[model samples]
Target: MNAIEIINISKTYKSKTKTITALNNISLEIKEGELFGLIGPDGAGKSSLFRILATVLLPDVGSAKILNYDVIKNFKNIRKLIGYMPGRFSLYQDLSVEENLKFFATIFETTIEENYDLISDIYKQIEPFKNRRAGKLSGGMKQKLALSCALIHKPKILLLDEPTTGVDPVSRKEFWEILKKLKSQGITILVSTPYMDEANLCDRIALIQNGKILDVDLPENIVNKFDKDIFSVASDNMFLLLNDLRNYSHTLSCFAFGDSHHLVIERNKADENLLIQYLSRHKNLSVKKIEPTIEDCFMQMLQSEN
Candidate 1:
């Protein structure tokens, strides 16, 4: 059976004259043991979906099942079957790392030692300062502790919403490593994040924006599906150069990526030689063809969504 199944799930909030729809008939199925990712930026409904799966909220329309338990009607049972880590650090900060773990375990009427081995690898990293108050810990250590608390009960499914958003680079890598370790223990994980790079870490991903799923596929496969060719253009006047490129009818899409802007052209009509001479009219500039990447695909996806 699918670990999680969401069919035509839709949610909205209302206040006087304003009604904001958070999810728009979103549907997906995640197989057991798959590390599924709901990829999107802030306010794109990633957290809303996670909250619904975690049983903290109800969908206004449609249904969601976790392990065959309806998220709305069987919310209590569903809560006991999964662990959730919200986008923000919602753990009890005044409590020590060890205390927080104990608190969560106590909520489920279980002890940490009962499932010590399940979170042992992760707990070890935070064992040294186990007595330190959670609020005093750095971003990375706090994340580790939260993961430990979530895993203490060995829930069948893990729901993480933007878990690594504010953490440093090293910590982000470490956090993902911890997740992979959890995945190996026969647990299904549903993680959401805005980072395009993290899409490759999941077994499958649903790229979402404006409460809509643009596509669902492996990261590499999604990148390979870019219909238009791409090129990289950089110049001393990069800002002005991008504006000029965007004005051209031949340019399908253009977005700045680090030191270069990935440019999609309609056809060979705007090839390197043509672009070079056209760009030469401006100040110091360079243009070269380049392969498309996940970020490029995401950019194109966002463009199409608009």
Candidate 2:
């Protein structure tokens, strides 16, 4: 059975006279035991969709199901079988690390000891400081505590919304490791994040933009779909280099990618010898063709979809 299913789900919020559509006609199916990811930038509606699936908010239209439980009608049952970690840490500030975990377990009518093994790997990081107030913990430590509490009940599905947004790089890697471990336990997982690098970590992902689904597939597959010869160029004069590339008749699209700029050939235009000599004569820069990455493919897809 599909772990989660959503059909043409759309959510809109009204403020004064303006109506903002947070989620469009979004439709997706997540298989049981799969680690599915929702990837997009802020205001792309990743959190809105997560909240709807977690039964925290209702869609303006459409239907959704989590493990065959209706998100709208079976709200109580759905809430019991799902573990939700929002983008922000919402644990009790005055409570200690151990106290917070115990409080969550009690809400689910369970004890921390009963499900200690489920959170042992994560809990161990903060267990030594269990008596410390949760508000006093570092960002990484707080993340661990929130995740530990989420798993205390051993829910059937896990929903994480930008769980690694502000955490350190080391902590982000550690968090993904925890998700992999949880996936091995057969708990279907759905995580959403604005970070492009995190998209590849998932088994599959749906790239969203402006409340719309652009493409849904494995990260490698999406990159493989990119058509056209792409190249990368870097120079000390970044601004001048971009302008020179744009003036070239053969350049299709040129955008900065970190220290280098990525370029696409202008339709059927492929001439390395002539292009190099042209840029040398014009921008006095070094350039070479390079492979496309997920971000490159995303740009292509976005432009095409638009």
Candidate 3:
């Protein structure tokens, strides 16, 4: 059986004056022991979908099943088999690190000693701060504690929502390492993040936006789908250069990427000389053809949709 199965699932929130759709006709199947990523920004329905699978919310249409157990009908069974870590730190701020872990263990009728091997790698990092109140711990320390508690019961599937957001670069790297180790132990992981760079770390990723899925594929395959010559164009006056390039006849698309702007043009329109002559009319610009990254592909997809 698939680790998780979602069929035509959709969710919407209604209020006094307006209605908002959080998820729209989404369907996906995650393989057993696969690391799947939901890549998107805030309000992309990631949280809504996650809450549904976690059995905390219900979808307006369709159904979801975890390990062959229906989310709606067998929520308790599903809950027992999955470890869910919300985006925010939901642990008790007044409690010590050890106390928080013990509390969750008690809820699941499990002891830290019973699952120590499952969380030893992560729990070891925060053991030094066991006496510190959860509120007093650093961002990374809190993240470790949360993950340890989530895995305390040795659930088969792990659902982490934006676990690395607001974390330092080093901490993010360390967190992904921990995930890699867990995957080796035969656990299915479904993680969500807004960072495009993290998409490649997953076995497969689905790019989501406006409650809709733009594309779902392996990261390299997604990059290869970008079928255009991309060029990095920048000049002394960046603002004017952006405007000039946008108005240029051969410029198919242009968007600011980091310190330089990435521009896409038709196959035959990839002429450096022509681009230089066209942009020099406004300002002296430097241009070079560049490889398209996941972010570039995401932008291209969004542009095509518009």
Candidate 4:
């Protein structure tokens, strides 16, 4: 069964001088017990779409349903069935860690003990600082606390918006581990993130940009769909090398990836020797055929769109 359904949903923000579309005819379905990811960079309308699903914001057009409850007409029922952790920390800063969790439980008419098993692994990490004010905890600790509160009611679906953003790498890893456990227990998860590497961790992902979904598929499938031959080129002068590669006659697309540049040329048109001789003037030059990654696919999609 599908846990969430969004059909032709659209949202826009207007000010005196500008009108910005946050979502443009978006439609998607997330299956029950699936860990789905909404992948995109900042200002890509991830938050706006999430807000609509969480029933916190109404869509300007179309409609959404969570667990079969219409977001507009059945918000109260929908709210009771989902756990939402917004991109920002929304818990009470003045409340102590325990207080915040208990407060949320109270609002849902449930006790932490009743759902203790659901949040036990996460709560234990923050229990030591239970008496500490929420504002006094570190970023990672704050994240754990917020998650614990979100799960306090044992909601069937979890909507986590950039939950790992601004968190330390170690904490991010730990948090994803927690998510895996939650998925094993049959909680449907829809997580949004700008981190391309994290896309692989999801069961399926939707890549979004400028309020539009570029593609949706398994990470490996998306990478495999990249049809062009790409080579990773590196030289002593990285900046100059990038400009030269982009200007090369056979170059189709070239983008800097870490210390090297990934260059895509007209398929099967350039040999290693030809590329080497062309770049012979550069010192420490190296070029090797490489497979495309999720980020590479995303860049290629964006380039094609333009």
Which residue segments of model 2 deviate by more than 4 Å?
A: 266-268, 281-284
Kindly list the per-residue Cα lDDT of model 1 for residues 1-306, writing each as its tens digit. Answer: 899999999999899999998999999999999999988888999988998899888899999999999998899899898999998977898999899999999999999999999999989999999899999999999998888888888899999889999999999999888889888889999999888889889889999887888899887889888878788888888888889888766888888888988889765666677777767767667777777777788888888777
TM-score, every prediction: 0.97, 0.95, 0.97, 0.98
lDDT of 4 by residue, 1-306 (tens): 789999999999999999999999999999999999999999999999999999999899999988889999999999999999999978899999999999999999999889999999999999999999999999999999999988999999999999999999999999999999999999999999999999999999999999999999999999988888899999999999999898888899999998899998766887888888888889999899998899999999999989
> lDDT (CA) for every model shown?
0.88, 0.89, 0.93, 0.94
Full candidate order by lDDT, most accurate first: 4, 3, 2, 1
In terms of lDDT, the best-performing candidate is 4
lDDT of 3 by residue, 175-284 (tens): 99999999999999999999999999999999999888999899999998888999999888889888888988877889999999999898666779978887875555
Clashing pairs in 4: none
Worst ten in a row by lDDT for model 4: 265-274
Worst 10 residues of 2 by lDDT: 277-286
Better of 2 and 3 by lDDT: 3
In terms of lDDT, the poorest run of 10 residues in model 3 is 277-286
Q: Give candidate 4's TM-score.
A: 0.98
Off by over 4 Å in 4: none
lDDT of 4: 0.94
Over the stretch 207-281, how does candidate 2's per-residue lDDT look in tens digits? 998889999999889887777888888777888888888877877778899888888885357788877776674
